[model samples]
Target: MITQEKYRTTVKELLANGTIKMAIGYRPGSTPDRRRPLFIRTSEEADQLVLDSTCITNLSGYLVTEGLLSDEKQVGIFLRPEGIRSINILAAEYQLNVDQIVIFGFDSTGREVRPLQGRNAGDFSALLTEIKENPPLTSKEPLLERVEKMNAKERFDFWQEEFSRCIKCYACRQACPMCYCRRCIVDSNQPQWINTSSHTLGNFEWNVVRAFHLSGRCVQCGNCDRACPVNIPLRLINQRMAKEVVDGFDHFAGLSPTQEPVLASFKKDDTETFIL
Candidate 1:
């Protein structure tokens, strides 16, 4: 397990050596057990760096914020395995140059903080490959299973009930790293694609559009799920769409920096069963 002292030493050295202009890591939050994102600008601030199971916010989301990387200078970020994968997806989508980012990778295996070997996201290709080959055990959520067992009409009613509670706060979108659009379709009042209100129909449209937009791009980090205040099962919808993309397009999201987005690329050899 990597201690906080060791983590701070590494960050301090990086900042002092000018390897990175800023270091995005974690610090103790308001609650004792909670951790929040911490930005380190100087070596003196490095002592605040912390790495543990509580450091679970996908820090890669910060990489693409407007004006955050505008300087085009190198920035260091503390990343878990999923955050590394998000970097790959970001690179693949041409959101940022991979070389401009340095990854201080770490993973919490049970209670131990294990440092990952990688300077950049691509360096962890083998680790990602291993994850792909031997996927993690997904404990079945009874609620998801129950929804899956329902008939189409019953499932619709279930989601409608769930979405009805949405306040249209857009917290889910704001938390998602992939929902980086400057102007979401719902926000287009000139020709509103989706209702901006939080009524039942509007909520349904908002959630469906959100899920579809994330179909082939979602990293499955459950950021949206965690961000939703109403406890909507956003992960289940994302998982179902992810499985459909895998079965239909034979593509998985966020595996490599060079891999093209599943929906953006086309080949002549591609099948068109839905084209009639």
Candidate 2:
């Protein structure tokens, strides 16, 4: 494994040599329990850059948000797969301008560079395909078959019960790499998409709406679940969306940023026969 000191040294060298103005890496927290993203603006702070498992928050969440140091500058995200999908979804949603971001991302194997996850890897689409035939819920054609078995009222009630423990901390949204907006619809005061109170209804409404918005783009990074204070399985919705985006569009975000979004670009042959 790369030593922390060596990692910092690498950042310094990159600062002197690379086109990147800022490198968003991580540093060992004061203790074992904390490791936060280190924003190195100068060569001196390059010594602070570190990377570890505890560097858990999806770094891409900051891309269009705080991630971008400024609009006039270019930024690079140290992505794996999760960040790619989120940024791709953001680009498709017009939340991000793709040209402004650079892909300093590498593969799990540290292979050659390309867009999204890696240039060569598939969406693990084969993995989703293998599971599609035998989904977790039941022996159904689609897991949604089992999911939809519950009526809207039942679905609403179920989410209410599931998110009842929510603290309205926005940890899920904050951790979501794809949840980038100067101001989220939920946070807008003029329209107030959802109430600010941390009541059950408000939580449920926000959760469901956000999940639906991410339906065709989420890459199942599971950062939101990891970030959750109460451990909500928000990835269920993301995994559900990933499966749907693949099944419907044969496209998966994060697999390749160069590829177009399924919703934004469609073919004449795209499916229209509802199995209902």
Candidate 3:
């Protein structure tokens, strides 16, 4: 409660002094455990802000909404560490200017909310590095382990069963911060790269392409996984791809705004063992 009030006061001060043009935070939803995005343009709106464990959505995606940052003025936002990572990736991809964002960062342990010590993405380098070094236990979760133990044919059967449930809704793409492409590959009809229907083959192709695109770029925020109405294990696929990059290229996504994308860069000594 004290932490929430402190941020509310800070947000009001920022708005009052014109330090920021707007703040993106959270507010009560239809239920107590739910939180909806709140955009604060004035001091009164700051009073409605709520910050806690339920504030898990990556609000960074809203920063990319058309014209929100076109005026080139500063905008404040509440961010967890992963949200900070999302913003860093956005800045790296030339989607937004990090300088124009004022981060109101926080994290939670169970239900206790705590403030992070940075107001800028660069300020949290050490924290992000620590996360890279010691990822969460969920990285080696039981479901992922079960999938990993399966033989190639069994693995194919498992995913075939899961992908069979897909309806081509594209909610996973919509929820992902990295999937900011204006016209997704699935939407292209020029050459028809992927089938538009929700058949099993089309579902497999779509999910595989998305995972490959996120190989060295996913922050593993679980947004796509949660957004899947059919409960596809999108996180597991993304995590496996992330591990491939870490193992093959020593790359960690969103480490810094200026870091080169791993798959896009090349070196003479790059491994070719998988070529065969």
| Tens digits of lDDT, candidate 1, 76-184 | 9998877888898899988988998999988876778878897887899999888767656543357667888999999989999999999999999999888888889
- Residue 100 local lDDT, model 3: 95
lDDT string for model 2 (1-276, tens) is: 354455456556656776567777667777885777777868887766655445545677776666464555656555554555566666666666766665444333232223223211234334334434454342223544555688988876766777898889998888777776667888888878797788988888888888887777776666788789997767776677767777878665644345566666779888879857
lDDT per residue, candidate 3, 66-95, as tens digits?
Answer: 899999999999998888888888898899
Greater TM-score among 2 and 3 belongs to 3
Q: Candidates' lDDT values, in order?
A: 0.85, 0.64, 0.91
> In model 2, which runs have C-alpha deviations exceeding 4 angstroms?
3-7, 66-72, 91-158, 189-193, 267-269, 273-276
Clashes of each: 0, 2, 0
TM-score of each: 0.94, 0.72, 0.97
Q: In angstroms, how far off is 233's CA in candidate 2?
A: 1.1
Clash pairs, candidate 2, are: 62-67, 85-254
Which number leads on lDDT? 3
Best by TM-score: 3
Candidate 2 global TM-score: 0.72
